[model samples]
Target: MTEKIAVLGAGSWGSMLAAILNENGHEVQLWTRSAAQADELNQKHTNRAYIQNYTFPENLRASTDLETVLTGATEILFIVPAQATRAVATEVDRILAKLGQRPALIHGSKGLETTTHLRVSQILAETISPEHRTSISVISGPSHAEGVVKHDPTLVTVASDDFDAAQRFQHLFMNDYFRVYTNADVIGVEFGGALKNIIALASGALAGLGYGDNARAALMTRGVAEISRLGVSFGANPLTFAGLSGMGDVIVTATSTNSRNYRAGYQLGQGVPLADVVANMGMVIEGIATSQSAYELAQTTGISMPITEAIHAVLEQEETVETAIHHLMTREGQAENG
Candidate 1:
C-alpha cells in the first residue's frame, strides 16, 4: 500500500530515506525549513548540500510548510540531529494539532540532548503526547546515508515499546537492498546507537595517532564493555547490544571513513582544534556532543566508562589526546568480564 509520509529534516539521512520511500512507491514529502532547499529538491531532484551531485528520485516531494507536509500523512519520520529534536518535535506537535491526527512517529537520528541527555525518542515522547501520536519508534544500525542511497546491502533495526508499531516500520522500509529487523528493546537500540558514536571518536583518534588495528580492536572491545555496562544499568536487554544497533553500529562507525564522528576524532588526534574539526566537517559531529552527555550520565549512574570519559576529556576539558590516553592506560586493572 502506498502511504503518505512526512519526513522532517533535509540532511543526508532525511533525503536518503525520502528517496527510498519514493522508490518504494510511497508518497513522501521531504520537509526542510529552507525554502531554497525545497525548491532545489523539487526542481533539481537533488540535495547537493548533504549528498553532493547525486540526484534524488523524481517522485519525492519537498516542502517548507509543515502543515502541507503533515497533512493526512500516515508516518512522520524525524532525521534531524539529536540536539535539534525537541524544537522540531514541538513544531510538529503544533502542526499536528491543526490536522487532528496522530500519525505513527519514527526517528532515525542518534544521540542525546545536550543537558537533558535524553534520547531522540525520549524527546519526542516528551513533546508529542500519547494522545497526539499513535506510537514512537526508532530505526538505527550501521547503515550510512551514502551507502544506503547507492543501494548497498544495509540492515537496521526498528524498535518500539509497541510491537505492532515496530512491525509497521519494519514493513515500511524493508526491500531487497535494505533489510529491517524488528526489536522490542527500544532502550537498548536507542542507547546503542547514541553511545557507539563516542567509541568511534576514540577509534578514529587512535587511527590518527598512527595506532594500528590492534589498538582499535582493543578499544572497540573495551568500548562494547562500556556500552553494555551503561546500557544494562538503564534496564536494557544485554543481548540487544550484541545485535545491529550495538556491535554492528560500532564496527561501521569506528572503522569507516564515512562516519563523521570517526573523521572528527581523526582530526582531533592530528591536533586539529575541536572548533576547526567541526567547522571543516560541515556536518554535525554527534559524538562531540554525545561525549559530554554520556560522561555526565555515566557519572550519575555510578558506572565505569573510562573510554567515554577519555573522549569527553578531549572534547570538553581541553585535555590533550596523549594525556587522555595515558590516563586510560594507567587505570587500575580489572577482569575483562567485570
Candidate 2:
C-alpha cells in the first residue's frame, strides 16, 4: 500500500531518507526550516550543500509549511538533531492537535537529550500529546547517509515498543540495496545507536594521533564492553550491543571518514580547537554531547566507564587528549570481562 510520509528536517540523513522513500513508491514530503533549501530541492531536485553530486527524485517534494506537510501524512519521520527533537515534536503536537491527525512517529536521529538524558523516543513521547502520539519507532544501524545515498548495500534495525509499528517500518524501508530488521528492544537499540558515537570519537582520535591497528582494535573492543555495561544498567539487553546498531554501528562510524564525530575527534587529536572543528564541519557531532551524557549516566549508575569518562574529560574539561590516553593506559589492570 502506498503511504504519504512526512520527513521532518532537511539535513543529509533526512534528505537521503526522503529520497529512499520516494524510490520505494511513497509520496514523500520533506519539510525543512529553510525556505531557500525547499526551493532549491523543488527547483533543482538537489541538495548540493549536504549531499553534493546527487539529485533527489522529482516526485519527492520539499516544503517549509509544517501544516501542509503534516495534513495528510500517514507517517512522520523526525531526523533533526537530538537537541532540537523536543521543540520540533512540540510544534508537530500543536499542529496535529489542530488538524486532528495521528501519524506513526519514526525518529532516525541518534543521541540522548543532554538535559534530561532521555532518548529521542522518550523526548518525543513527552512532547507530543497522548492523542496524537501514534506508534513510535526508531530506525538505526551502521548505515550512513553518504552510503545510503549511493545505494550501497546497507543493513539497519527498526525497534519499537510496539511490535506492529516496527514491522511496518521494516516493510516500508527494506529493499534490494537496504535491509531492515525488527527488534522490540527499544532501550538497547537506542543505546547502541547513541553510545557507539562516543566510541567512534575515541577511535578517530586514536587514528588521528597516529596509533596503529592494534590500538584501534583495542579501543573498539573495550569501547563496546563499556557501552554494554552502561546499557545493561539502563535495562537494555546486552546482546543488542552485539548486533547491528551496536557492534555494526561502532565499526563503521569509528572507521569511516563520513562520520562527523570521527572527523571532529581527529581534529581534536591533532590539537585543533573544538570550535574550529565544529565550524569547519558544518554538521552536528553528536558524540560530543553524548559523551557528556554517558559519562554522567555512568557516574549516577555507579558503572565504571573509563573510556567514556576519558572522552568526556577531553571534550568538556581542558584535559589534553594525550593525557587522557595516558590515564586510560595507566588504569589498574583487570580481567577482560571484568
Compared with the true structure, all predictions reach lDDT values of 0.92, 0.91
- Where is model 2 more than 4 Å wrong at Cα? none
Error of 2 at 9 (Å): 1.1
After superposition, the stretches of candidate 1 with alpha carbons farther than 4 Å from their true spots are: none
Can you write out model 2's per-residue Cα lDDT over 22-109, one digit (the tens) per residue?
8999999999999999999999999988888898899889999999999889999999999899999999999999999989999999
Q: What is the lDDT of candidate 1?
A: 0.92
Q: Report the C-alpha lDDT of model 1 over 36-112, residue by residue, as the tens digit.
A: 99999999998988897689888788999888999999999999999999999998998888779889999999898
* Candidate 2 lDDT trough over 10 residues, lowest sum: 312-321
Clashing pairs in 2: none
Backbone clash total, candidate 1 = 0
* Count of residue pairs whose backbone atoms collide, per candidate: 0, 0
After TM-score superposition, the amount by which residue 254's alpha carbon in candidate 1 deviates from its true location, in angstroms, is 0.6
Estimated TM-score per prediction?
0.98, 0.98
